[model samples]
Target: MSLYGEFSVPTDAFALHYTLEQIQEITIETERVVATEVGLTNYFWVSGCNLDEFETVSEKDPSIQNLRRLDEFDRATLFRAEWTEQVDAIIFAYLEIGATILEATGSHDEWHFCMRFDTHDRLDQFQDHCDDQGISFRLTKLHEITQPHTGSQFGLTEKQSEALVTAWKMDYFTTANVTLADVASELGITPQSLSERLQRGYQSLIANTIVVTPPSD
Candidate 1:
C-alpha cells in the first residue's frame, strides 16, 4: 500500500479563514488536525494528524507525552497512516464531531508559511470536508515522489529529514552564526524545540549522510 497520497482540485478549494464565528470554530476544530492535510493527499505532503484521537490519548487520556520515538506531530500522523488499512481515509471527519482544535504553532520552526495538521486523510476526504465546511480545500495528485523525497523512504519523518539536511548543509564546524533562536525563528518555533529537532536531525544525518566534503583548494 502507498504510504503517502495527494489529490488536487480547483485553486479556490479551501479558504484560509472565514468571517462567521461558527465557521471559525469549524476551522478551529478541523484545524486541530492541521492544514498539512489540507492540500495534498499524500501522507508526506499532508501536514498534521488528529492529536486528540491518538491511541495514547484515546486509551486513557494519553497526553502528547505518550509518544515515544517521534514528536507529537510525527506520531499523530504515523498513527493515522498505520491505524487504518486504507491510507486514503477522511481524517477531517473528526471535525464534524467538533474535534478540539489545537492551533498549530508553526512547522518545525523552519519556515513562516510551513504549517502542519495533527490530521491525516485521503485526498478525497480532504476535498469533501472543504466542500462541507463551505471552504475550498483541494487536492493535488503527485505522480511520483522524487527519490530521497524524504526520510520516510528510509523510515524517517520530515523532522528527521530536516536534521539530516541541516547537518550536511552545515559542517559540524559551526552554525555559530545561526543560533538555535535564529533557527527557531526561521522555523517559527521556540529555541528549545529547535534544538531538539536539530539534535534528532543531526543524529539521523550523521547515521545516514555522514561524509567528508572535499576541502577547498
Candidate 2:
C-alpha cells in the first residue's frame, strides 16, 4: 500500500542554508535538485521585505549559484536558485527510493517534508539511506493513503497552522465577540498582515479539505 511520510531534515544537511538564514517566512517547494542542476521556482515569501533586499541576501550566499525572481505577489515571490554539490546526494536519495515529495517548507534551521512512497518499505529505505549517510532526520508522521487527499487534507505552513489553531481556541471566529485585531496582537503581527495570512490559510484549507461535486447533466 502507498504510504505517506512526514519527516524533517535539518538545514545543515540540505541546501539553501543561507537563504533560510536571511528570511524567516520563506517557504520552498523544490521542483528539482540534482547533481548538475537545481530549481526551486516557487513563491519565496517574507513578511516585510522587497525584491532588492531578497536579492541582496541571496547574493551573499555562495552555495546559491543563481537566484532569479520569476514573479511576485502580495507577500511572496517565485524564485529559482541553483545549488552546489551539497544537496545532490539527498535529492538523489529521494529519487533512489522512488519517493514523491508532496510538500516541503522550512528555513535555515530545519525543514519539514510530506512525501509519498510506493509502500512503507520504500519510506523505511529512504530513512535508512539517510541514516547510513549520517544525515540526521526526524520522522513526524507515517500513514497509508487509502484515498485521494484533497481539500482539507492539505497541510498548513507552520505560521498558518499556529494562527488557525490560536484563533480557533480563542474563538476569534465567533461573531464580533473577539476581534481580528485582538488575535493579530496576540500573534505579534499587524491586523492587516494577520488578515492576509488567515485569508490565504482559509483558501488553502478550503481548497484542500472541501469536496466539490459536479451537477448531473
Candidate 3:
C-alpha cells in the first residue's frame, strides 16, 4: 500500500537559504516541478515580501539559477527557476524513490513537505537516502493510504479535508466563531498554510461539483 508522509527540514538543508535569510518574512510554496536532463526546473509562489528585493536576493542564492518572474498576483508572485540538484538532497532523494510531492511550503526557518511513496519500503529508502546524504528532517506525519482515490473523489487533499471538516465542526462557517488561526492551531499548521489549503479546497470543490462543461455543438 502507498504511504503519505509529512516532514520539515531547515532552510539551509534545502534550497533558497540565501533568499530566506535576506527576506525574513517571506513564505514560499511549490507550484510545480519538472525534471530535466541537466537539473530540476521549479515554479514557486512567493509572498510576504517585495518582488524586487526577492529578485535581488535570489541572484545571490547559489542554489537557484535563471530565476524569472512568471506572473504577478494580488498576494503572491510566481517565479520559475532552475535548482542546483547537487545541493538539494531531499529533492534528489524524492526523485530516486519515485515519490510524489503533494504539497510543499517554506519559511525563513524551515521547509515543510508532504509526499506520497509507493510503499513502506520506498518511504524507508527515501529516509535512508537522505540520511546518507547528511540531510536531516523532522517527520511530522505518516500514514497508509487506505483509500487512494479519496482525494479525487472529493477534490481535496487529506490536509484540505481535515481543515475543512475541523473548521465546520467548530462552527467556523455558520457562526464565524472559530477563526482561521484557531483552525490552523488545531491542525498544527500555520494560518497561512491552512488558508492556502482552504482556498485550494474551495476551488477544487467548485471545479469538480458545480462547474460543468457545455456540450459540443
Candidate 4:
C-alpha cells in the first residue's frame, strides 16, 4: 500500500536558506518541480516581501540558480528557478526513492513537506537515505493510503481533507457567519495553517479533477 508522510525541516537545512535569512517575513510555496539532468527546476510562489529584493537576495542563495520571475498576483509573485542538485540532498533522496512531493511550503524558520511513497519500504529507504546524508527532519504525520477513490483520490492530504470538511460543515463557503478563525478554532490549528491546508486542498482537487487532459490521438 502507498504511504503518506508529513515532515518539517529547518530552512537552513533545505533550499533557499540564504534567501529566507535575508527576507525573514517572506513565505514560499512550491507550485511544481521537474528533475533535470544536473538539477531540479522549480516553480514557486513568494509573498510578504519586495519581489525585487527577493530576487536580489536569491542571487546569493547557493541552492538556487537561474531564478526568474514568472507571474505576479495580488499577494504573491511566481518564480521559476533551478535548484542545484548538490545543495538539496533531501530532495535528491526523494527523487531517488520515487517519492512524490504533494505539497511544500516554507517560511523563515522551517519548511513543511507532504510526500507520498509507493510502499512502506520505500518510505523507510527514504528515511535511511536522509539519515545517511545527515539530513534531519521531523516526521509530523504518517499513514497508509487505504482509499484511492476518496480523499487520496483527489490528491488531498489527510490534514487538507480535515480542514476542508470542517470548514464546509461550518458553512464557511456558504455564509459569512463563519470565518476562517472559527474553522481554525474547530480544527485546533492556527488560522494561517488552516488557510494553507484549504488552499492546497483546493489546488489538489482542481488539478486532479478539473484540469484533466484527454488522451492524445
- What lDDT score belongs to each candidate, Candidate 1 first? 0.33, 0.65, 0.78, 0.80
Q: Tell how far residue 184 is off in model 1, in angstroms.
A: 3.2
Off by over 4 Å in 1: 1-57, 60-143, 147-149, 172-175, 199-217
Residue pairs in clash, model 2: 150-208, 151-208, 151-209, 152-208, 152-209
Native-referenced Cα lDDT, model 1:
0.33
In model 2, which regions exceed 4 Å deviation? 22-48, 148-217
Every model: Cα RMSD to truth: 13.5, 7.5, 5.6, 4.4
Query: Of models 2 and 4, which has the larger TM-score?
Result: 4
lDDT of 3 by residue, 12-36 (tens): 8878878987799999987656677
Error of 4 at 19 (Å): 0.5
> Per-residue lDDT tens digits of candidate 2, residues 124-205?
7887878878888798998887866432235455456678878888899876788999999899998877876676577557
Candidate 3 Cα misplacement greater than 4 A, ranges: 85-87, 150-217
Error of 3 at 190 (Å): 13
Number of the candidate with higher TM-score, 1 or 4: 4
Per-residue lDDT of 68 in model 2: 73
- Each model's TM-score, in the order given? 0.33, 0.60, 0.71, 0.71
User: Ten residues in a row with the worst lDDT in model 1?
Assistant: 21-30
